[model samples]
Target: MYPQRDVRVRHARDLAFSLLTPEDAFELLAFEIAERAWFEQHIEARREQFYTPHGMSQHIIECLALNAQGRMSPLLIRHKGVIIGRANLHDIDQNSARVGYRLAENACGQGIAHKALNHLMKEARCIYGLDTLTATVSVDNKASQRVLEKAKFTVVDKLPTYSQVVDQRLGCVVYQCALREKVECP
Candidate 1:
């Protein structure tokens, strides 16, 4: 469905957003391995297979299939051509989609996550003709919650015992954003 392996979506300062492709396997693997522990702090850990080369290849193929089916968009966030994070629009339908994203440990606190999310919102709104987007944030992840709020997402509900990480249970907040041509941000 895609003419090129890595089609650029848009750029946010030095950060580039692009459709994920098979060629991204190596760098993406390195990024995932380096940030595994850091990511697990705010979210549940991924399966061990995800850190393997073969596993990543399979994952990318599945993601591209969904992208081709027009049910999802898997994006890689890069800085200076290096993978630093990811943002994805999943479960896309006629009027809504679920959005999720993560940034590397070193990339945190740099406003990159929020910027990437906003760009994803644009894609969902304009490109996909979506009317709403939803995201779930772990209750303990205050930073992400704040970003969602700043992006105009409203809390609609909460999921109890949303995730099990190691020995702890983390509840999650469900947020929904209504798409608008103009997004007011401070």
Candidate 2:
């Protein structure tokens, strides 16, 4: 059986992040529908850069299921109850979990992504028993890379053609950090 991971409704700074229940499929669908054009035109490229639509949505379903089972936890980032973005621990393993996220185009440059990531990194270390975390960013995504860097994810290596979408090969940089050695929890 999986453990009872934390269900945080609000952050220390009083920001709102919500847990997505399977029953909340409509909400998720609504979010997807509202953000479709934004996601397709902007985020879709990154989704393809990172994963397939089937892959991303399937993984989200699996993550939501695991959240119910207590094996995994994912938080949807919202501001004043408006769905703006998402961040979660994926590739959850015995020792560590990988993380990824996407924000609405309008949600960019406001430090919300950084705040969400900081929250999850704390969960991974203090609650999930993870010692390390990993993430990948497209070489051109300086904003995301900055967010990760702000959260202390260090550049570990340059992976060539690490991501492919629609027959296009894009290079990526992998970043990592030990959850215990750095990042003080709030």
Q: lDDT for each of the candidates? A: 0.86, 0.71
Residue pairs of candidate 1 with colliding backbone atoms: none
Candidate 1 lDDT, 59-174, residue by residue in tens: 99999999999999999998878788999999999999999999877777778878988999999987898889999999988999999999989999999999987679989999
TM-score of model number 1: 0.90
RMSD, every candidate, angstroms: 6.2, 7.9
Model 2 stretches astray by more than 4 angstroms: 1-14, 40-61, 68-71, 184-186
Best by TM-score: 1
State the lDDT at 100 in candidate 2.
Answer: 81
Native-vs-model 2 lDDT?
0.71
